[model samples]
Target: MIVAQAKPIEEILEMIDKYDKILLVGCKGCVAVCAAGGEKEVQFLASAIRTARKTQGREIEIREVTLERQCDPEYVEQIRGFAGDYQAILSIACGVGVQFMAEHYREIPALPGLNTSFMGGALEQGVWSERCQGCGNCVLHLTGGICPITRCSKSLLNGPCGGSSNGKCEVDPEVDCGWQLIIERLKALGEFESRFMEIVPIKDWSTSRDGGPRKIVREDMRQ
Candidate 1:
């Protein structure tokens, strides 16, 4: 899932400062699972913005709404009739969601309310650790289930690096060295040597991001 964190209250205020009426749009998709942008977060932010504006006697008009998702065009269209009523919209979704809103609603000023963190999963009660770099290639077939590209601090495909000591990452003692995890998992499955005999190739990031625009053609499913 895409992970994100809410922007500071001050930054948000600055974004909407010029607008007399603003719409605070929350997403119930990635942000909801991460506890950053949901209905509750929307209300909290709405109140905070109102309170901050009231302190300066600005009397800003702010409205709040939460959608099932902001990244989808259909979900964004649900707010079309209501969007014209506000001067600006602050989307509390991932970067994709913010862009989706902008693409769909070109008439209004759409601003992002959260900083998209990464592709990660909940580590524990609150911590979220990035697990995928979306390198366009998946190597989970080898080295057990661990991903050295994302888990290792140095993204070493062949190793725990010289800095790793006692299965711990040398960069951060708190983190479990990814290579170590892979080795252990491979050992358990009795395919330790079979999986990692060949050195992994350097990653080709071209297919990942900014290489070019992405497109998928389904020849068999033509209408």
Candidate 2:
């Protein structure tokens, strides 16, 4: 899922300091699962903002709302009726949601309340680690279910560069060599010879962000 972290309260306050009334919009999607932006988080932020403003003898109004998703047009449209009621919208969704809201409501200021981190999964309790880069290709089969592109420091197609030592990456001793994990797993499965011996061709980045923007459409769905 897309991981994100909340921006500092001071930064958020600065974004909407000029506005007397603001809308704190949260997303119950990826950000919610990550505990960054959700219904509970929205309430917390609204209270914090109000307290901060009250200390300065300035009265401010903040209305909190959580949407099922901010990226989808259907869910985004749900806020259309009352969006203009606020001076600015503080979106606690991912960067994509903030941009989507900005475009959808061109006249209203869409302020980001979180820093979009990366595409990753929870490693353990309260710990999240980066796992995928979404390179628009899948090579897990050949690498014993390990991704060289995302795991390897250099993203080497065929690697464990000369810098690898003791099964550790040269970039960081704490980091395990991506190829070492792949080789060990493949060796245990007795497929090292078959898989490791096969040469992997250079990846075609055109399928990724090399092209300006990508879209997928299904004619069957349209029908």
Candidate 3:
């Protein structure tokens, strides 16, 4: 899932300080699962903003709403009816969601409340680590299911760099060497001799960001 972290309250306050009334939008999507932007978080932020403004001798009104997803146009349209009532919109969703809101409501300012972190999964409760770079290439078959592109500090394709030592990356002793993990995994699967011996070709990056923003269309899903 896409992981994100909330921006500092001070920065958020500065973004909306000029507006007396604003729409606080939350997404019940990836951000919600990560506890950064969700229904409960929206309420908490609203209260905090109000309290902060009150102490400054200023009054502000905020309307809180949580959308099933801010990335989908269908869900974004749901707010069109009353979005005009606000001076601006504050979205606590991922960067994509903020952009979608901004595109949909061109009349009002759409501001981001969270910093889009990366695409990753929860390692444990309250701990999430990045696992993929969405390189548009899958090399797990050649690496025993361990991703060399993301797990490796250097994004090495063939093998570990000279900096690896004691199964750990020299870049950070706490981080395990990506290739080391792959070698161990292949050995466990009894395919180390077969898989590890085969060399991976130079990666084709055209499928990734090298070509700029990407999009996909399925003829089967089109109207």
TM-scores for the candidates? 0.93, 0.93, 0.97
lDDT per residue, candidate 2, 1-223, as tens digits? Answer: 8999999999998988899998889999999999999999999999999999999899998989999999999998999999999999899999989998998999999999999998999988778877888888788988998889888999999867899899999999988899999999999989999988788898998767786587889988995
Q: What is every candidate's alpha-carbon RMSD to the true fold?
A: 1.7, 1.6, 1.0
Alpha-carbon shift of residue 174 in model 1 (angstroms): 1.9
Candidate 1: list runs displaced more than 4 Å. Answer: 219-223
Which residue pairs does candidate 2 place in steric collision? none
Question: Between which residue pairs do clashes occur in model 3?
Answer: none
True-structure Cα RMSD, model 2 = 1.6
State the C-alpha lDDT per candidate.
0.88, 0.91, 0.94
Which candidate comes out best when scored by TM-score?
Answer: 3
lDDT of 3 by residue, 129-212 (tens): 898899887888878898999999989887889998999999999899999999999999998999876787888998888979
For residues 125-219, write the lDDT of model 1, one tens digit per residue: 88998888887778888868788888999888886779889989988899999999999999999989887777777778777775776666899
Which portions of model 3 show Cα errors greater than 4 Å?
Answer: none
